[model samples]
Target: MTLDPLAALAGLGFGLSLIVAIGAQNAFVLRQGLLRRHVLAVVVVCAASDAVLILLGIAGAGVVFAAIPWLTTAVRIAGAAFLLGYAVLAARRAVRPRALEAGDPQASPGLAATVLACLALTWLNPHVYLDTVVLLGSVANTHGDSRWLFGAGAAVGSVLWFTALGYGARLLQPVFARPAAWRILDAVIAVVMAGIAVSLLLGL
Candidate 1:
């Protein structure tokens, strides 16, 4: 039941490894950061969502995910499809450079919507379950009763990372203001998303 420092460190490292990858959540965070629009809100939603999932994983949700083979397969297919769709959308945005709507200096996605979006992005994706719940949880297995501490460490890491990424991206806002820069970024996102989708589909 005691907190094992080694297990906590392993869990923290594993959590960070899975999160640092580029994905829809990262893309959204970067956009919000660069626009200085809802940056804090995005971070709160993302971090809290991760905390919940990480806890669930520590509580053996990974076993549930693994138990249902068909469900896992469905999630994989769905996640791949969503990635491809998002890729197409990104490519369209790149081709048709449209002016972004004036960000409401005060307007923001409602708390409910923000929470829902975060949960959907974090939970609905099979990759999240596979990486955080399964992979990271497996690392905490040695902690036995102290698995909660491991999950806590992982949650703390998620909070730290999201905050850094959200705010760090704002530093590049001035450079991204250029229309060409936006186009290029969109193109890059499209390519990345497409590549991820292909990788998932091929089970790579």
Candidate 2:
């Protein structure tokens, strides 16, 4: 069967939008990227982890959302709340930008420790599941038979994003050292999250 371009595009757009945010997982990836410590391994783990979770959401989580319509509404409402709260944090960070603490590459932990920390940050966090399994899953299911295509798009996005972030972080070091850079980034995040939250609530 031919894949629906619209469905795939929708998935890619939504997946990138959802994943490109200030979160524990992204922060870890950013830090690892900056340090240049196990960059390939870290990137692979994150992208692979996201692919697995996306499958769970697209294949199974959507089923749960289907069985309970009320839960879907609740999850949407909760997602809105999550987005708004994320916006608040981003706004606060923009007001008080943090200093770059990438530290010495020589002092970075061993590969095992680094991988374990990355795993902990990604899997142990509840927010990951919310974003991927619940929110993305529900939205993908709405696409009907094209949902897997949507999921595939999302997986592709995850791979692309992690690869870019991991590989491109070195280029950002000089600029990111300035607090002003973080302030601008946080401000953009705030606006994006707030707009998304407001739109989600309006849809409900």
Kindly list the per-residue Cα lDDT of model 2 for residues 1-204, writing each as its tens digit: 455779988989999999897665676577578667799999999999998989999877746755877765665576667667656866776775242234534335789987886776566444577789888988988888899999999999999999999889889989867767766766776786677567657766
List where candidate 2 sits over 4 angstroms from the true fold: 1-3, 62-106, 175-204
Backbone N/Cα/C clashes per model: 0, 0
* Consecutive 10-residue window with the lowest summed lDDT within model 2: 97-106
Candidate 1 clash pair list: none
The digit string of per-residue lDDT tens for model 1 on 1-204 reads 365677667667767888998887887677667667667888998888888778777778888877888888777777778778767876876776453322533222555665565555565577778877787778766679778778888888888889999899967877776778877877887888777677767872
lDDT of 1: 0.74
Candidate 1 ranges beyond 4 A from true positions: 5-7, 100-118
Candidate 2: residue 106 Cα off by (Å): 5.9
**Candidate 2, position 20, lDDT:** 92
